[model samples]
Target: MRILFIGDIVGRSGRTALSSRLPGLITEWKLDLVVVNGENAAGGFGITEAIYNEFIDAGADAVTLGNHSWDQREALVFIERAPRLIRPLNYPAGTPGRGAAMIEAKNGARALVINAMARIFMDPLDDPFAAIDRELAACPLGEGADAIVVDFHGEATSEKQAMGCFCDGRASLVVGTHTHVPTADHRILPARTAFISDVGMTGDFDSVIGMNKDEPLNRFLRKIATSRFEPASGPATLCGLAVETDAKGLAGKVAPVRLGGGLEEARPGFWP
Candidate 1:
C-alpha cells in the first residue's frame, strides 16, 4: 500500500499549495491513501467546516487535528458530523469527535488512522500510549486493517520519537506534526514502522512557523502582543512523508516530501 501523510496546513498559503499540487501527486505517485493534518487550516488557529470539506475535496481520505482542534468554535459542533475528521484520541472522554477512524482507501483497502496528542509540554491529556494501544489492539494490522497510520502531534521531539518507538511494529507509519519545521530524520525503524520526528507544516517558510514574521518577532523582542498572529501570505511549501507498506502492513520504504515555495524540493525515488 502506498500512503501519503501531509503535515499541518496553516491558513490560505498552505491550503493553496495543497489545492494546486495534491491532485497531481495523487496521480503521479499513484497514492492509495492520503491523510492531512488540518488543525491550523483556519488562519493558523483551527479548522472550520468549509476547510474540512475543502481538504476532503482535495483528495484527503482522512483529516487529523491537534491542540488547535477546538480553536475554531464551530469545530466543537461540526466535528461530530464529519466522520473523516479525527481529533486526539487521548482527549477527555467526552470530547466531540473521534480520536481514530477506519476509512477505505481509493483501492478499497482499509486504513486505520489514529490521531493522538502528547502531554509533554502540551495540554495534559490521557495517556496517548494506552489510548492508541486500545485502538491498535481492536484492529490488529494485517488482520483487521490493511494499514495503520499514527499522527503523533506534539512539541517535544523526545515524546514524538518515543511514540514512534512505542508503536514500532504495530503501525505502518508514525509521523509527527505541530512543529511546523521539517526534520531530516525520515527513516524506517528497526521494527519496520516509518518514523519522522516531524513532517513540518505546509505553509510559508519565510515566516515564523507559518505565521507572519512581525508579530512573533515582536512577541519575542518586547514580550507584548501588539496584534494577532496571522498566517503568512507568501507561497507555501507542501511538506509530508510518503510510505510504501508491505502486505503485512509494515512500512517497506519511507521518504520525505518537500515541494514548492521556499524549501528545497524532495521526492520519493521509488515513485518514479
Candidate 2:
C-alpha cells in the first residue's frame, strides 16, 4: 500500500495548497491511503467541521489532530459524528472523538490510523506509549489491518523519535507533527517502519512556523503580544511523507514531499 501522511496544516494558506494539490497527487502517485494532520487548519488555531469535511472530500482517508484539536469550539460537539477525524489518543478517557480509526483505503484495504500526543513540553496526558501499544495490539498490522499509520504530534524531537522506535516493527509509518519544520531524517527503521522527526506543515514556510512573521518577531523582541498571530497568506508549500508498505505491512520505500512556496520541490522518485 502506498500511504501519504501530510503534516499539520495552518490556516487558509495550508488549506488552499491542500485543496489545489492533494487530489492530483492522489491520482498521480496512485496513493492507496492518505492521512492529514489538521490541528491548525483554522486561522492557525484549530480545525472546524467544514475543514475536516473538506479534507475528507479531497481524498483524505483520515485526518489527525494535536493539542489544537479543540481550538475550534464546534469541534467539541461535532467530533462525535466525524469518524475519520482522530484526536490525540492520550487525551483523558472522555475526550470527544476517537484517537484511532480503522478506515478502508481507496484500494479497499483496511488501514488503522492512530493519533497520539507526546507529553514532553506538551499537554500532560495519559501514557502515549501505553495507549499506542494497546491500540497496536488490538489492530496489529498484517492481521487486524493491512496497514497502520501513527501520527505522533509533539514538541520534542526526542519524544517523537522514542515513539517511532517503540512502534518500529508494528506500524507502517510513524511521522511527527507540531514543529512545522521539515527534517531530513526520514528513513526506514531497523524493524521496517518508516520514521521521521517531522514532515513539516502544508503552509507558507516564508514566515515563522506558518504564521505571519511580524507578530512572532514582535513577541521575540518586545516580549508582549501586540496582535494576534495570523497565518501567512502567501503561497503555501504542501509538505508530507510518502511510504510504500510491503506485503507484511512494513514500510519499504520512504520519501519526503515538499512542493511550491519556499521549499525546494520534492516528490517520491520511486513513484514517478
Candidate 3:
C-alpha cells in the first residue's frame, strides 16, 4: 500500500499549491491513501467544513488535525459528521470527534488512521501513549485493518522519536507534524515502521512555520508583544512524507515529499 501524508496546510497559498499539484501527484504516484494535516487550513487557524471538503475533493483520503483542531467554533459540530476527519486521540472522552478512523482505499485496502498530540510543551491532556495504545488495540494492525498510519502531532523531536519507536512494529508508518520544518531523518525504523521526526508544513517557508516572520522577530527583539501573527502570503512549499507498506502492513520504504515553490529544497518520491 502506498500512502502519502502531508503536513500542516497553512493559508491560501498552501491550499492553492495543494489544489493545483495534488491531483497530478496522486495520479503519478498511484497512491492508495492520502492524509493531510489541516488544523491550519482555514486562514492558519482551524479547518472549516468547506475547506475540509475541498481537501477531500482534492485527493486527500483523510484529513488530520492537531492542537488547533477546534479553533473554528463551527468545527465542534462539523467534525462529528465528517468521518474522514480525525483529531487528537488524547482529547477528553466526550470530545466532539474521533481521534482515529478507518477507511477503505480505492483498491479495497483498509487503512486505520490515527491522530495523536504530544504533551511536551503542549496542552495537558490524556496520556498520548496510553491513548494510542487503546486506539491501536481497537484496530489491531493487519487483522482488524490492512494498515495503520499515525500522525504524531507534536513539538519536541525527542517525544516524536519516542512515539515512533513505541509504535514501530505495530503501525505501518509513524510520521510527525506541527513543527512545519521537514527533518532529514526519513527512514524505516528497526521494526519496519516508516518514521520521520516532522513531515513539515505545506506553507510558505519564507516565514516562521507559515506565519509572518516580522511579528515573531519583533517579539524576540523587543521582548514585548505587538501585533497578531498572520500566515505568510508568499510562495508556499508543500511538504510531507510518502511510504510504501508491504502486504503485512509494515513499511518497506519511505521518502520525504517536498514540492512546489518557497524556501526549502523539494524532494519527491524516489521509489515507484
Candidate 4:
C-alpha cells in the first residue's frame, strides 16, 4: 500500500494547494490511502464541514486532527457524521468522534488510521501509548488489515520520535505533525514503520511555519505579543511523507513529500 500523510493544512492557501495538487499526486504515486492533518484547515484554527468535504472530494481517504481540533465549533457535528475524520485518541474518553478508523483503499485494502496527540508542550491528555496499545490489540496487524498509519500530532520532536519508536513494527507508518516545520528524519525504522519527526505544514513556506512572518517576528523581538497570527498569502507548499507499505502492514520505504512552491529541495517520490 502506498500512503501519503500530509501535515497541517493552514488556511486558504493550504486548501488551495491541496485541492490543486493532491489528485495529481494520488495518480502519480498510485497512493492507496491519503491522510491529511486538518486541524488548521480553517483560517489557521480548526476544520469546517465545507473544508472537510473539500478534502474528501480532493482525494483524502482520512482527515486527522491536532490540539486545535475543536477550534471550529461546527466541526463537532461534522466530525461525528464523517467517519473518515478523526480527532486525537488521547482526548478525554467522552470526546466527540473517534480517534481511529478503518479506511478502505481503492483496491479494497483495509488500512487502520489512528490519530493521537502528545502531552508534552500541550494540554493534558490520556496516555497515548496505552490508548494505541488497546487499539492495536483490538485490530492487530495483518489478519485482514493491509496497513496501519498513525498521525502523531505533537509539538516536541522528542515526544513524536518516542511515539514512533514505541509504535515501530506495530504500525506501517508513524508520521508526526503539529510544529508546522518539516523535519528531515524520514526513514524506515528498525521495526519497519515509516517514521518522520514532523511532516511540516502544507502552506506558505515563506512565512513563519505558514503564518505571516510579521507577527512571529514581532513576538520574538518584543517580549510581549502585538499582532494576530495570519496565514501568509503566497504560493503554498504541500508538505508530507510518502511511504510504501508491504501487505503485512510494514513500511518498505519512505520519503519526504514536498510540492508546489516552497523552501527546501523537494522531489515527488522515490522507492528508497
Q: Where does candidate 4 have its weakest 10-residue lDDT segment?
A: 263-272
Q: Per-residue alpha-carbon lDDT of model 1 for 120-212, expressed as tens digits?
A: 999999999999999999999999999999999999999999999999999999999999999999999999999999999999999999999
Tens digits of per-residue lDDT for model 3 on 1-272? 88899999999989998898899888888889999999999989999999999999999999999999999999999998899999999999899999999988867899999999999999998999999998787788888889899999999999999999999889999999998889999999998999999998999888988999999999999988798879998888889898888888998878888887665555544654
In order, candidate lDDTs are 0.96, 0.95, 0.90, 0.89
User: Cα deviation of 89 in candidate 2 (Å)?
Assistant: 0.3
User: Which parts of model 1 are misplaced by more than 4 Å?
Assistant: none
Q: For candidate 2, which ten residues in a row score worst on lDDT? A: 88-97
Residue-pair clashes per prediction, in order, are 0, 0, 0, 0
lDDT of 2 by residue, 128-174 (tens): 99999999999889999999999999999999999999999999999
**Candidate 2: segments with Cα more than 4 A from true spot:** none
Better of 1 and 4 by TM-score: 1
In lDDT terms, which candidate is top? Answer: 1
Error of 4 at 73 (Å): 0.7
Error of 3 at 226 (Å): 2.3
TM-score attained by model 2: 0.99
Candidate 4 RMSD to the correct structure? 1.5
